[model samples]
Target: MMPKITTNRRKWKADLMNRVQTVDDNDRPATDYTFKRVTYFKPLGVTAQEKALSVQEKAEVVKRINIVMDHTINTKDFGIRIGEQLYNIERIWTDDEKREMELSLSYVD
Candidate 1:
């Protein structure tokens, strides 16, 4: 057998045909009826380089560097392969290079 209507069709039908009362005279146009261009901003990839660290940031940097340096030296003493690579990287890092890196590190990190 066909099922009885479970929904109220009259209430739903009346909603779409409801009359709207105008605030202004029907002849005068709305001043702010400007159609703003629908802006479709593409999915923004909010990726960017890290900013330079300030003195507060530098403190964290120094702490990390010291710990890393100690780890590298200890690894070298133990004859680990990475110890040499770490040391080599250390050699390549001059004071000027470090300062520059410190400035840029915040952004990268």
Candidate 2:
């Protein structure tokens, strides 16, 4: 199904990042890592789901977002960052026409 234009409002801005391996002064790979910002996108929509057993329960939070089709994103090397929270791309689905892509993301925490 095509995304509804009205519902697909570009309200949220997110950063597309590529994981980068750090190197030590001697040029050896370091244990630490960083991310390089690939691009910024204003998502068509942002949906957040939080499941909890009780009012005080801390549950897993998942975020789903839709954006215009971008060829630069690959699940193996990229991630999405919204605000201060970083998420791993769990799955990616593209529309039949390749006009849009839906990303299922899981919170890093």
Q: In candidate 1, which residue ranges exceed 4 Å CA deviation?
A: 1-35, 50-109
Model 1 agreement with the true structure over 55-102: per-residue lDDT tens digits: 434422211121111212221112111111211111112244222111
Model 2: CA > 4 A from native = 1-8, 23-61, 96-98
Candidate 2 lDDT over 1-109, as tens digits, reads 9875664455667878776667889999844225665443444333333233211344243666777788777776777888888877766778858477887666764
lDDT scores in order? 0.20, 0.64
Question: Which residue pairs clash within candidate 1?
Answer: 50-107, 50-108, 51-107
Among the numbered candidates, top lDDT falls to 2
What's the residue-level lDDT of 32 in candidate 2?
A: 29
Best by TM-score: 2
Cα RMSD to native, each candidate? Answer: 30.7, 7.0
